[model samples]
Each structure stands twice: as C-alpha cells, then as structure tokens.
Target: MRILVLANFGMGLYNFRKELLKELIKNNHEVFISLPKDEYKPKLEEIGCEFIDTPVSRRGTNPITDFKLFMNYKKIIKEIKPDIVLTYTIKPNVYGGLACRVTKTPCIVNITGLGTAVENGGVLQRITLYLYRISLKKVNCVFFQNEENKKTLIKSKAIVGKNMVLPGSGVNLEHYNLMEYPKPQVVNFLFISRIMKEKGIDQYLEAASYLKQKYSNVNFHIVGFCESEYKNKLTNMQDKGVIEYHGKQSDVKRFYEISHCTVHPSYYPEGMSNVLLESAACGRPIITTNRSGCGEVVDEGVNGYKVKPENSNDLIEKMEKFLNLSYETKVKMGLSGRRKVEIQFNRRTVIDTYLAEIHNITER
Candidate 1:
C-alpha cells in the first residue's frame, strides 16, 4: 500500500510519527510525506521515505492563497495516485481533504486541535467550520484527539457520529520512560509549550509571580520558543524574575527529569497535550487547565490536578499543593502518572489504531 501523510510542518510529523512510519515500512507499506521543506529532509530520506515539498501558510487565512494551495495539492494527489492520504492540522485537513476528494482518493483527517480561528469564533470561524463540514463529508474517516473536539464537531455537524476519538499523538514511552522521582530541592515547576499568549503564558507568569512572593523556594522554568508577538510579554515576565525561560529545546527529557511537576495553563483549545503526557511518562505529576483536551488527561488528585484556565489563583493553588506535598507523596503521585500513561497513552497503541484505521479505509 502507498500512503501519503500531509502536514504543514516537517519537524512535527518527522519527530512524532517516526515510530509509526517505521512500523509501516516494516510491514512493507510505502509511506510518503508531504510537508514544507525543512532541516528534516535528510532525516526523512534516511528513514527510507520519499518526501514532497509543499508550501503552506500556517498562521493566516487568505482565500486566494488557500485556493492556490488547494489546486497545488490537487495536482500532487493526482500525480502521486496514493492508495490513501492522511492529513493533520487545520489547513491540511480542510484543503487537503478537498484535494483528495477531487482526485477520488480516500483521505483521513486527524484534527490535532481546534486552532485559534475556530476556537475564537467569528466570521473566520464560521467560514472555516462551513468548509470543514463540506470537506469532511467526502472524507473516509475523521480522527479527533479528544472528546471535546469530537463533541464540538458533532454539534457543528462537521463530522458524523462514528468518527474515532484518539488520545493525542501518543507519547514515546521509550524516550520518555519513568525516571526515578526527583527529590524537590527547590520545588521546581516546568511549563513546556510554544510561548504564545493563548497558551496561558500570562496566567503561568502571574501564578509564578504570586507563588515566588510567598514561597521563595519555588522556581518556575519555561521551555519553548516565543513567537514575536508574545516576546515582549515573555520578556517582561522574565525581567520581573517570575520565571526562567529556556528557549526551544530539542531534548526536554532532562528538564522533566529534574522538575517535580509540570504545569500547562493553556486556555487554547488543545487536542491532547504532548507535554503533559511526556511529563506523566517521565513519572512527574502534572497541573494543567481544566479545558477540553487538557482536562481529559488528568485524574485529578490521583495523578495530577486540573485548575481553571486563566485563573491565576487556581493555578497557584495547585502549584502550592505540589509544593506542600511530602517527598513520599510526590513520589506516589509521579508513579500514578506513569501508570496512567502505561495504560492509556502508549505510543504503540496509538500507532496500531491508526494503522488499523488506514487499512480499513484503504480496503473499502
């Protein structure tokens, strides 16, 4: 079977889906990737996969450009004649699915998250949702990362009732294995995400500031790139000594190993948070917002805590819980998190499910 995976960015697919790609190759399936040209090109080739460069505008919505993208994608699909196409993210899922439909090729769309456009809701949101409803009608299957997204799709009639709900791209347990629970020397809290205001960065900073004033022993560490728009806010927070920003990191496991807990206060409608899953896989407790995708991962008092999104008081309270817990209690919470991932978010399970779905769609 020949499969084409379409996405906006190269690194995300290359890194997160490597295991799945390897499995497909091992099974004698031909897998091709379609993404923007990036540093991962050599790596993708080395993995025995063919790469196709496609230009994509990830941040904006322009009808003329989007039409051109759709036409380009249509041409590519016609030329490749892939048995099936798998797409992720908003632009690919909408425009790519339409292109596949034009070529009469079966396509599966994985809604990774309801991006700012749809979540924010207005004229753009209405238009995008209408496009989704139209495009999805032709898709073989739609995969959602969390229940909230699935519910929203169903409510909006964008997808049918039988669509699959997958837990976010499963965490790589091998790479994020349970580390020996670290003793909290300073009650270090880590937030790993793109430093966007939508990700509740301000809330995190506010919580960090409030905590630091009360408990001098507490420390906040942030890991990820700051978009230009939000750079000033991040800079302001850092200047105020609210948090230590460790710019984009290729290796996040080290930070997870040293930190006592992970905090993701994002109000953005997420799919499933890979950071939270990775933290849990590393045997570290998590404190995240009680919003859609974020809320689905935690078991409250058992493995982690869920605080209200954008509520600095709630976030600070949860952080204080971790700070106040006995070393033994913290260790137990971390163990519980590891157990949760083992039973639910294992990468193998996600890969297997995806493969089975692909086979089912292609066979039909």
Candidate 2:
C-alpha cells in the first residue's frame, strides 16, 4: 500500500509521526509526504519517504490562497494516487480532505487542535465548521485526540464517518525515558510550548512574575518559539531576570532533565498537549489548565494539579504547592506521571492504532 501524509508543517510530521511512518515502511508500505519543504525534509527523506514540496502557508487565511492550496492537494493526490491519505493540522485536514474526496481516495484526518478560530467562536469559526462538515463528509476515518474534541466535532456536525479517539499522538516512552527527579537547590518550573496568547503564555508569565517576587530561589524557564508579536515582551521579561526564555530548542530533553515541574497553562483547544506528555514521560510533574485534552492528562493532585484556565492566581497557587512540598513527595509525583504515560499515552499504542486503521482502509 502507498500512503500519502499531508500536514501544514514538515517538522511536525518528523517530530510526532516519525515512528508511525517508520512502522509503515517496516510493513513494506510505500510512503509519500507532502508538506512545505523545510529542514526536516532531509530527515524524512533519510527515512525512505518520497517528499513532495507542498505550498502550505500556515498564516494565510485569504480565500484565493486557500483555493490554490486545495488545487495543489488535488494535483498531488491525482499524481501520487495513494492507497490511503492521512492528514493533520487545520488547512491540510480541511482542504486535503476535500481533495481526497474529489479524487475518490480513502482519507483519514487527525484533529490535532481546534485552534483559536474555533475557540473564539466567531464568523471564522462558523465558516470553518461548515467547511469541515463538507470536507470530512466522505472521509473514511477521523481520528480525535480526546473525547472533548470529538464531542465538539459531533456537536458541530462536522464528521460523517467513523471517529476514533487517540491518546494525543502518544509519547515515545523509550525516547523520553523516566529518569530520577532532579534535586536542585532551587526549584525549577519549565514551560514548554509555542509562545502564543491562546496557549496561556500570558498567564504563565504573570504567575512567574508574582512568584518571583516572593520566591527568590525558584526559577522559571520557557523553551519554545515565541511568536513575533510576543518576542519583545518575552525578551523584556528575560532581561529583567523574571524568566529565562530559550527561543525554540530542538533538544528539550536536556532542559526537562534539570526541571522539577512542567507548566502548560494552555487554554487553546488542543487534541492533547505534546509538552505535557513528554514532561510526564520524563518523570516530571505537570501543572496545566483544567480544560479538555490539557486537563485530561492530570488526575488532580495525583500525577499533577490542574489550575483554572487563564488564571494566573490559580497557577501561582499550584506552583507554590510544588515549592512547599518535600523533595521526596515531588519525586513521587514525577514517578506517578511516568506511570500514567506508560499506561495510557505510550507511542506504541498510537502506532498500532494507525497501522490498524490504514489496513482497514486499504483492505476494504
């Protein structure tokens, strides 16, 4: 079987679904990946994937550009003639699914995140919901990362095919092995995510600022790409020594190794947060928003604690609890997180699910 994977960004495929693609290759399936060419292209190529440079503009919401993207997907699907098409991200899932439908190709879409457009609930959300309803009407399978996201889709009448919930792309337990919790003199709290407003970055910053005044020994670190608009603010905060901001790190495991807890105060609708998953896999306790996908990862003070979405005070309270806890208790919390990942969010489970779905689509 020949499988064509479509996504908005190339690196995302390499980072998250590389194992699944490798599994496909091991099973003797020809794999083709279509995404905007970037540094990760070489990595995917090295893994025996035929790469097609796709023109996918992540920030382009213009009608003409989107129509062109649709046409491009149609051209690629027609040329590749794949046995099954798997898509991720917003534009690819919507436009690519439409192309798959038009080309009479079996398609599966992974609802990674609903995004701010849907979360904000406006004209764009209405338009997106309508587009999704039409585009996914004929898709063979729709993979949702969590039940809340699935319910949102069903409530919006977007999916017309079989829907399956996955464990948020699932974490590679071997790659992110559980390690002994670090026992640094000062407590370290790390936030790993793209610096976006919807991701509750503002809340994290506010919490860090307030906590810093009281707890001089505690350190706050952020590791991810800061959006252009938020760069200056983050730089200013870094200059003031309020937080240490390492812009876009490829090797996040090193930072996780030193960190005591992972904070992902995200209000953005996510399928499941990869940051929290990796942190847990690395045996770090998490403090995230009490919302779908993000909230589901926590067992409420078992593995970690869930704070109210966009509430800096609530986040401060949780972080304070971590600071006040004994080192041994925190280590136990970290171990609990590792256990949760092994039981529910292992990457092997995700790979097996994809393989089964692909076989079902092709064999049928």
Candidate 3:
C-alpha cells in the first residue's frame, strides 16, 4: 500500500511517527510524509520516507491561509493517489481529511490535541469545531491520544461511536528505557514543552520560586523552543531565576537522565503529553496539571502527582511531595512509571494499532 502521512511540522512526524513509518516499510508499504520544511528533512529522508513540504502555522487560525493550505493538500492528494492517508495534529486532520475526501481516498486522522483555540472557547473554537465535524465525516477512523479529547469530539458531534484511543504517540521503550534515577548534587526539575504561556509556564515559574525559597538544593530546567509570542514571558521567567531555560534540545534524553522529576503544568488542553510519556519511559516521575491528557498518565500516588491547572499553590504542594519522598520511595515511583509505559504506552502497541487501522481501511 502507498501511504501518505500529513502533519504540521517535519520534526513532529520524524520524532513522533518514526516507529509507525518503520513498521509500514517493514510490511512493504511505500510511505510519503508531508510537513512544513524543517531541519529534520534529512532525518525523514534517511528513514526511507519521501518528504513533501507543506507550509503551516503552528499557532493561531487564519481562514485565508488555511484555505490555501487546504487547496495545496487537495492538489497533493490528487497527484499522489495514495492508497490511504493518515494525518495528525489540527490543520492536517481537518484540511488533510477534507482533501482526501475529495480524492475519495480513505483517511485516518489522529487528533493529537484540541489546541488553545478549542480550550479557550470563542468564535474561533466554534468555527474550528464546525470544520472538524465536516472534515471528519469522511474519515474511516479517528484516533485520539486521550479520552477527554475523544469525548469532547463525540460531544461536539465531530466524532462518534467507538473511536480509537492510544496513549500519546506511545514512547519507544527501548530508546527511553529505564535509567537509574540520577542522584545529582542538586535536585533538578525539568519542564519539557514548547514555551507557551498556555502550557502554564507562569505557574511553573511561580512554583519554582516558591520551592527555591525553602529548598536551596533544587534547580529548575526548562527545555524547548521559545515561540516569538511567548518569548518575552519566557525571558521574564529566566530573569527571575525561576527556570534555567535550555531552548530546543535535540537530545532530551540527556536532560531526562539528569533530572529528578519532569514537570508539565499545562492548563491548555493537550492530547497525551509526549514529554510525560518519555519521562515515564525514562523512569522519571512527572508533575503535571490535573487536566485531561496530563492527568491521565499519572496514577496519582503510584507513579507521579497531578496538580490543579494554573495554580502555583497546587504545583508547589506536588513538588513538595516529591521533595519529601524517601530516596527508596522515589526510586520505587520511577520504577512504577517505567512499568506503566511498558504495559500501556509502548511504541510497538501504537505502531501495530496504526498499521492495523490503515490496513483495515485500505482493505475495505
């Protein structure tokens, strides 16, 4: 089968869907990936997948630009005549699905997250939901990273009836296998996410400040690219010694190895958070918001803690729990996290699920 995979960014497809792509190739499927051109093009090509540049804005909604994107995707779909189309993220899932519909090609859309527009709830949110409902009508299957998103789609009538749900992009257990819970001289807490205010960076900074006042032995690390809209806020957080911002890291495993705990206080709606899964796979406990995708990963006291979204006090309390845990208990929590991923969020399970769905759709 010839498969076309569409995502917003090249790096997103390269990093998140590599296992699925490899599995398809192993099964003698020809794969073509469409994404915004990025430095990761070489890496995508190296994986034996053809890459096509599709310009897209990661943030905000513009109908004019989106229509152009839709037309561009429609042209690509007509030209490729792929046996099946699989899409991820917001724009691709919406516009790509629509384009595939025009070509009478089967589409499998993965709703990674609802994004800020939906979470914020306004005219844009309503319009996006309307578009989603229309686009999804022709999709053969819809995969969701979290139950909340799946439920939301169903409630909004965007998707209904037994939709597939997978845990994030399923972390590669072999690649992010359990590491010894590092015993650094100073305890380090790392927040790995795009520098977005909606991700609760402000709350994280506040918690870090609160923690630092009492616990001088702790260090806060922030990893990810700073978006221009949120750059000034990130800068202010850095100036306050709230976080040691390590912008856009290719080697996140290194940070995971050294960090004591992974924190993602995202108040914005998320699909399943990849960082939480990777951290858990790396045998690190997480501190994230008590919201849909973020809360689902942690089993409360078992592996990690969940705090109220955008509430620094709640985050501070959770951080204190980690700080207060006995060394043995901390190790045990990390091990529990690894076990959870092995059973529920393994990469093989995700890849197999995707392949099975794709085959089912094409066979029909």
Candidate 4:
C-alpha cells in the first residue's frame, strides 16, 4: 500500500511518528510524508519516506492562506493517488481530509489536540467545527488522543464516523525507559512544553516565584520553546534567578533525569501531554492540571498530584507538598509513574493499532 501521512510540522512527524513510518516500510509499504519543510525533513527522508513540502502556516488561520493550503493538498493527493491518507493536527485533518474526500481517498485522521481556537469558544470555534464536520464526513476512521476530545467531537457532531481513542501518541517505552531519579541537593522542579500562555507557563512562573522566596533549596527549571512574546520576560526571570529557562530542547530525557519532578500546568486542550508521559516513563513524578488529558496521566497522590487549572496558589501548594516529601516517598512516586506508563501508554500499542487499521482499510 502507498501511504501518505500529513501533518503541520515535519519535526512532529520525525519525533513522534517516525517509528510508525518505519514499520510501514518494513511491511513492504511505500510511504510519503507531506508537511512544511523543516530541519527534520532530511531525517524523515533518511528513513525512506518521500518527503513533500506542503504549505501550512501553523499559527495562522487566515482564510486565503488556508484555502491555498487546501488546494495544495488537493493537488498533491491527486497527483500521488496514495492508497491511504493519514493526517494529524488541525489543518491537515480538516483541509487535508477535505482534499482526500475530493479524490475519493480513504482518510484516517488523528486528533492530536483541538488548540485554543476550539477551546476558546467563539466564531473561530464554530468555523473550525463546521470544517471538521464536513471534512470528516467521508473519512474512513477518526482517532482521538483522549476520551474527552472524542466525546467533544462526537457530541458536537464533528465526527460521525468510526472513532477510537489512543494513548496520546503513546510513549516509546524502550526509548524512555526508567532512569535514575536525580538526587540533586536542591529539589528541582521542571516544566516542559511550548512556552505559551495557554500551556500555563504563567502559573508555573508564579509558583516558582513564591516557592523560590519561601524555600531557598528549591530550583525551578523550564525546558521548551519560548514564544516571542514571552522570550524577554523569561530571559529577565532567568537573569534574576527566578527560574532557569532552557529554550526548546530536542532531548527532554536528560532534563527529566536531572529534575525531581515534572510540572505541566497546561490548560491547553491537549490530546494528551507527551511531556507528562515521557517524564513518567523516566520515573519522574508529575504535577499537572486536573482537566482533559493532563488529569488522566496522574493518579492523584499516587504517581503525582493534580492542581486547579490556572491557579498559581494551588500549584504552589502542590510544589510545597513535594518539598515536604521524604526522598524515599518521592522516589516511590516516580516509580509508580513509570509503572503506569508501562501498563497503559506504550508506543508499541499505538503502532500495532495503526497497522491493524491500515490492514483493515487496505484489505477492503
């Protein structure tokens, strides 16, 4: 089977779904990946996927640009005439699905996250939902990363096709196997995600500020892309010793290994947070919001704690709880987090599920 995989970013494909693509090749399938070219395009090409550059402004929602993106997909899909089309993220799922529909090609869409447009609930949300409904109408299958999102899509009548919930994108257990928890003199807390307001960076910063003043032995570290608007402010905070910001790391495992705990106070409508799962797989306890996919990873006082969304005081309170914990207790919590990922969110499960669906779709 000839498979076409579509996404907004090539790096996302390289980092997250490279294993799946390799498996398809091993099964004697020709794979083509379509996304905006980035540093990772060569990596994807190296893995035997024919890379095609698709026009996608990941942060833009301008109609004219989006229409061009839609037309691009139409042109590419028609030219390639792939046997199966698998898409991820918003634009590819909506516009790419629509283009696939025109070619009468089977589409399998993975809803990674809804993003702020849908979560904010406004004219954009309505427009996005309408596009989703129309695009997904003729899709062969829809895979949602979490039950909350699946329920939302179904309830909103955006996805009326066969749907299944996956464990976010699933963590590669072998790659993220348990590591020795850091025994740093200072209790270090880490936040790993894109530095966006929606990701609850403000809450993390606020908690860090209060905790730093109260406890001199606590260290706050951030590892992720610092968005333009927050760069100067984060730099200021770093200089003042309010926090340690390492902008956009490719390998977060080292950060997780050195950190006492991982904090993800994200209020973003995520499919599931890969950061939390990776941290868990590395035997690091988590502190996150009690909403959507973030809440599901934590077992509340078992592997970690769940705090109120966007509430700095609550985050501070949880950080204090971690500070008060005995070293053995924290280690035990980290081990528990690793056990949870082993039992439920292994990447092989995700790969097998996709292969099974691919077989089913192609056999027909």
Candidate 5:
C-alpha cells in the first residue's frame, strides 16, 4: 500500500515514530512523509521514506495560512493518490484530515496532545474543537495519546466517529534499555521539556532553588530549547549554581545516564510525555505532576512520586521525599519504572497496533 504521513515537524517523527515507519517499509509498502524541512528530514529519507516539504506555521492560527495549508494538503493528496493517509499533531490532523475527506481517502489521525488552548477552555478551544469535528467526520480512525484527551473530545462532541486511545507514541525499549541507577552520593534530577510556562518550568526552577539551598549534594539539570522568555533566567540560574542548563540536546541518553531521577512538572495538556517514558525506560525514577499525562506513568510511591500541579511547595516536598529514600530503594524504584514501560509503553506495541488497524482498514 502507498502510505502518506503528514506532520508539523521532523523531530518527533524521527524520534518516536521511526520504528513504525521502518516496519511499514519492511513490509514492502511505499511511504511518503510530509512536513516542514527540518534537520531530521534527511534522516527520514535515509531510512527509505520520501520527504515532501509541507510548510506549517505550527503555533499560529492565521486563517489565510491555514487555508493555504488545507489547499496544499489537498493538492498533495490528489497528486500522490496514496492508498492511506496518516497525520500527527494539530494542523496535520485538521487540515490534512479535511483534505483526505474531500478526496474520499482513508486517513488516520494521532492526537499527540490537545495543547493549552483546548484544555484551558476559551474561544480558541471552541474553534479547534469545531475544526476537529468537521475534519474527522469521514476519517478511517482517530488515535488519542491518552484517555483524558479521548474523553475531552468525546464529551465536547468533537469526535463522534471511530476513535481509540494509545500510549502516546510508546517508548522504544531496545533503544532506551534499563541503565544502572546513578549513585546516591550526589543525587541528580533532570528536568527535560520545552522551556515554556505551560510546561511548569517555573515550578521546576522554584523547587530547584529551594532544594539546592537546602541540600549540598543534589544537582538540578535543565534540558530542551527555550520556547519562551527563559533564556536569561536559565543563564542566571546556571551561573549561580542553582541549576545546570544544557540547551537542546539531540542525544539525551548520556544525560539520563548520570541522573538518578527525572523531574517533569508540566501542567500542559500533553497526549503523553516522551521524556518521562524514555527516562523510565532507562530505569530512572520520576518526579512529575499529579495530572493525567504524567500521572499515568507513575504508580504513586511505587515507581515514583507525584506532586500537585503548579505547586512549587509540593514539588520541593516530593524532591525531599525522594532524597530521603535509601539508595537501594531508589534503584528498586527505577527498576519498577522500567518494568512498567516494558509492559505498557513499548514501541513495538504501538507499531503493531497501527499495522493491525491499517490492515483492517485496507482489507475492508
């Protein structure tokens, strides 16, 4: 079958969904990927997939630009004549999906995350929901990353068609196999996510500040590019010894190797957090928010601890709680997380599920 994939960027596809794409090619299917021309495009091409440069202004909601995107998708679909279509993120799901509908092509959409606009509740949320409702009407299937997202769309009547939930682009266990838990002498915590307000960077920074002053052996590390006005603040914090900032790393396994625990304080509407999944797969204990996307990974004191959303005090308290655990217990906690990911979030499971759905769709 000829398969076409639409997405906003290449980083996520190259990182998370490469396994699925590889499997499709191994099955002798011709695959074409459509997204903005980014660094990972060549990598995707190297993996035997054709790349189509589809300009997408990811964060903006300009009507003229969106209409152009819709038209572009329509043009691509009409020319390629793909047997099936797959789309990720918002613009691809909405606009790509609409194009597929008009062309009478089968399309599958993955709701990676709802973003703050939908979850925060506002005019934008209403507009986004309306777009989803119309675009997904005739699509073959809808895959949500989490149950909360599924419930929200269903309750809002945005998804009245066939849909199901998936473990947000499940982690690759082979790539991120269990690693030895770092020694407890200097307990290091990692905060990996885009430096945005919605991602709870402020809460993480606050916790880092208080904990660093209170404890001498602990180190707080920040990773990922700053999508907000946090460059100067991160620089200041790093210079002052409050946190160690490593801006945007393509390879994070080395950082995970030195870390004892991973911290994610995000309050954002995430489909699922790849950072937590990857960290857990690497046998690292996690300290994250007590929310859906994050809460699902942790087993509440079994694998890791969860703090109240946006509460710096609670975050500090949890870090202290983790700090007080015996070294042996920390190792056991990390192992527990590894076991969870292996059983529940393995990347193979996601790939097989997609293949099964695609097979069923085509056979019908």
Candidate 6:
C-alpha cells in the first residue's frame, strides 16, 4: 500500500511520528510525505519516505493562498495516486482532505489541535467550522488527540463522521526513557514550547520573575525559539540571572537532564501536550494548565499540579507548592509520571491504532 502524509512542518513529523513512519515501511508499505522541505527532510528520506516538498503557509487565512494549497494537494494526490492520505495539523487536514475526497481516495485526518482563532470563536471560528464540516464528511476517519477537542468539534457539528480519540500522539518511550529522578536542592524548572503569547509565555515569565525574587534556591529555564517581542525581555532576564534562555534546542534531553520539572503554561489549543508526555517519560514531573490538552496528563498532586489558564497568581502558587515539596516526594511524582506514560501513552499503541485504521480503510 502507498500512503501519503500531509503536514505543516518536518520536525513535527520527524520528532513525533518518525517511529510510525518507520513501522509502516517495515510492514512493506510505501510511504510518501508532503510537507515544506526542511533540514529534517533528509532524515525522512533516510527512513525510506519519498519526500514531496509542498510549501505551506501555516498561519495565514488568505483565500488565494489557501486555494493554491488546495490545488497543490489536488495535484499531488492526482499525480501520486496514493492508496490513502493522512493529514496532520489544520491547513493540511482541510485542504488535503478536500483533495482526497474529490479524487475519490481514502483519507484520515489527525486533529492535533484546533487553532487559537478556531477555538476563540467569532468570524474565524465560524469560517473554520464550515470548512471542517465540509472537509471531514468524506474522510475515512478522524483522529483527535484529546477528548475535549473531539467533543468541541462534535458539539459544533464540525465533524459528524467516524472519529476516535487518541492519547496525544503518544510519547516515544524508548527515545525518551525514564531517567533517574533528579535531586531538587536547587530546583530547575524548564518551560518547553514556542515562546509566543498564546503559549502562556507571559504567565511563565511573570511566574518566573515573581518566584525568582522570592526563592533563593530555585532556577527557571526557558527553552524553544523566542518570539521577536520577547527576545529583549528574555535577554534581560537571563542577564539578571532570573532565567537561562537557551535559544532553541534539537536535543531537549540534555536540558531535561539538569532540570527537575517541566512547566508548560500554554493556553493555546492543543490536541495533547507532547511536552508534558515527554517530560513524564523522562521521569520528570510536569506543571501545566488545568485545561484540556495539558490537564489530562496530570493526576492532581500525583504526577504534578495544574494551574488556572493565564493566571499568574495560580501559576506562582503551584510553582511555590512544587518548590516546598520534599526531594523524595518529587522523585515519587516523577515515578508516577513515568508509569503513566508507560501504561497509557506508549507510542506502539498509537502506531498500532493507526495501522489498524489504515488497513481497515484500505480493505474496504
């Protein structure tokens, strides 16, 4: 079987879904990926995938550009004549699903997360919903990362066809194996995500600034690419010894090595927070928002604490609560997190589900 995948970027596919792609090839399936060409494209080729460089505007809503993207998908689908198409993220799912439906091909869409505009409602939400409603009607299956996200779409009548909720793209347990729980004498808290406003960077920075002034033995570390506006702020903070801002990292495990906890303060709509999952898999406790994508990972005080979205006070309180915990208690929490991932979010389970769904659709 020939399977084609559409996505916004290369790292998202390479870092998160590479194992699935490898398994597909091992099972003797021909795999093709349609995405914007990037450094990871060469690595994807190394895994036996034939790469199709498809330029995508990830954040634009321009009708003309979107029409071109749709046309590109239509062209790719027609030329490749793939047995099935799999799409991830918003643009690909909408446009690729449309192309597949028109071409009379089986398509599966993975709703990684509803975008901020779609979730916030209003004119954009209405437009996105209308598009989703039309595009999803003909797809073979839709995969959602979180139950809340799935429910929202269903309630909004955006997706009425067959769909199933998946554990947020499941973590690669082997790749992020459990590490020995770190000593928290001088606790290091790491924040991993795009340093954008919607991702709760403000909340994190606020919490960090307030906490750094109060806690003498704690450190805050910011990871990922900083947005333009936040650049000077991060630099100033780092200069003042408030936080360590590593521009961007390909290997987060090294940072995780020295860190005691992972804090994702994102209010952004996400199918599931892989940052939380990977942190847990690395045997580190997580502090994240008490909302859908981030909420599902924490078991109250078991693995980590949850804070109210966009509330700096709540975030500060939680971080303080985490700081006061005994070192042994922190280790236990890390162990609980590792157990959660091993039992509930192993990547093999996610891959099996994908393969099963694909086979079911193809056999039909």
TM-score of every model? 0.96, 0.98, 0.95, 0.98, 0.99, 0.99
Model 3 RMSD vs true structure: 1.7
The superposed Cα distance between candidate 6 and the true structure at residue 342, in angstroms, equals: 1.1
Candidate number with the higher lDDT (4 or 5)? 5
Estimate, for each residue in 1-364, the C-alpha lDDT of model 2 and write its tens digit.
8899999887789889999999899889899999999999999999999999998888678999999999999999888889999999999999999999999999999999888788789899999899999999999999999898788889999986799999999999999999878876899999988899888899999989999999888999999988899999998999999999988987799999989999999988888999999999999999999888898789888889999988888999999998898888899999999999999999999899988888887888
- Candidate 6: C-alpha lDDT: 0.92
Question: What value does the lDDT take at residue 65 in candidate 3?
Answer: 92
- Per-residue CA lDDT of model 4 for 1-364, tens digit only, reads 8999999997778878989999999888999989988899889989899989887998797999999999999998888889999999999999999998888999899999988888999899999889999999999999999998888889889888798999989999889989998785789899999999989999999998888899889899999888899999899999999999888877878898788999999998999999999999999999999988899999999999999998999999998998999999999999999999998999889999999998898899
Show model 1 residue runs off by greater than 4 Å: 236-241
Count of clashes, each model? 0, 0, 1, 1, 0, 0
Q: Per-residue lDDT for 234-342 in model 5, tens only?
A: 9999999999999999999999999999999999988899999999999999999878888899999988999999899999999999999999999999999999999
Worst 10 residues of 1 by lDDT: 159-168
For candidate 1, give the lDDT of residue 109.
92
Q: Which stretches of candidate 5 lie over 4 Å from their true place?
A: none
Better of 3 and 4 by lDDT: 4
RMSD to the hidden true structure, all candidates: 1.5, 1.0, 1.7, 1.0, 0.8, 0.8
Error of 4 at 193 (Å): 1.1
Tell me the deviation in Å of residue 350 in model 4.
0.6
lDDT at residue 4 of model 2 (Cα atoms): 94
Tens digits of per-residue lDDT for model 6, 1-364: 9999999999999998999999999999999999999999999999999999999999998999999999999999999889999999999999999898889899999999999878788999999988988888899999999998899889888787899999989999988988987665699999988999989999989989999999899999988988899999999999999999988998889888888999998889988999999999998999999888899999999999999998999999999999998999999999999999999888888999999999999998
Compared with the true structure, model 6 gives a TM-score of 0.99
lDDT of 5 at 141: 91
- TM-score between candidate 1 and the true structure: 0.96
Q: Which ranges in model 3 have alpha carbons more than 4 Å from their true place?
A: 160-162, 228-242
Instruction: Report lDDT (CA) for all predictions.
Output: 0.87, 0.91, 0.87, 0.91, 0.93, 0.92
